[model samples]
Target: DGRCLKDIHCLELAEFRWTLKQAFGSSQPSARYGHTAAVWPPESEIPGRDKDSEFLFVFGGHSAVSELNDFFAFHIESSTWVKVDTGRQTSGPSKRFAHKWDWSGLKT
Candidate 1:
């Protein structure tokens, strides 16, 4: 349904959610390690809590392949992956390429 972005970064809510499921796939799939290879690569980012609060830096694990279209977010308080959903009407950034994201600590 989609194409792979070589040396690019994708930040999609759907992709992020799907990646979590893929990461926790059944034993059979995990054993093969094919699904894990097709997701996003490891990256580090600083998450801002508020305008005046300290920032939280998080690091993601590496994928098996170089191309990735999935995005995953972690909740520091809960210590879990919180999938963000970019609705169909929302348009901000290209879901591919070596694009980078920064946390501005502002709420929409």
Candidate 2:
């Protein structure tokens, strides 16, 4: 469900199609019925550097419980995924499914 703000419609059908294509490939049904699943709390509100440059990241959701120590950044300009590895074995919050993260900029 998309919320329209101040008479502004926020959902783009074409982008949705593109996203689905990226996730599932070709919009074709999978032979394995449960291969694709929805992520609960479907929104990740990472702040953008500007209108043209932004980072989009996603994590495992309810259907997938694996703790994701690995992440990838999507450079909109290049339209590619850059794998990010946090070499430091720092301990903090455990990786959780259905989690949303906002960019905190670079960590010192």
Scored by lDDT, the top model is: 2
RMSD of each: 12.9, 10.6
Which residue pairs clash in candidate 1?
A: 8-97, 8-98, 9-97, 13-84, 16-71
* Residue 24 Cα positional deviation in candidate 1, in Å, after optimal superposition: 9.8
lDDT scores of the candidates, listed in order: 0.30, 0.35
Estimate the TM-score for candidate 2.
Answer: 0.40
Query: Could you tell me the lDDT of residue 17 within candidate 2?
Result: 37
Candidate 2 residue spans exceeding 4 A from truth: 1-52, 60-65, 90-92, 103-108
Q: Per-residue CA lDDT of candidate 2, range 1-108, in tens?
A: 322111111235667633321322222221211121222122443343353454444332222323434444444433444554556547634545445555443541
> Model 1, residue 8: displacement in angstroms?
22
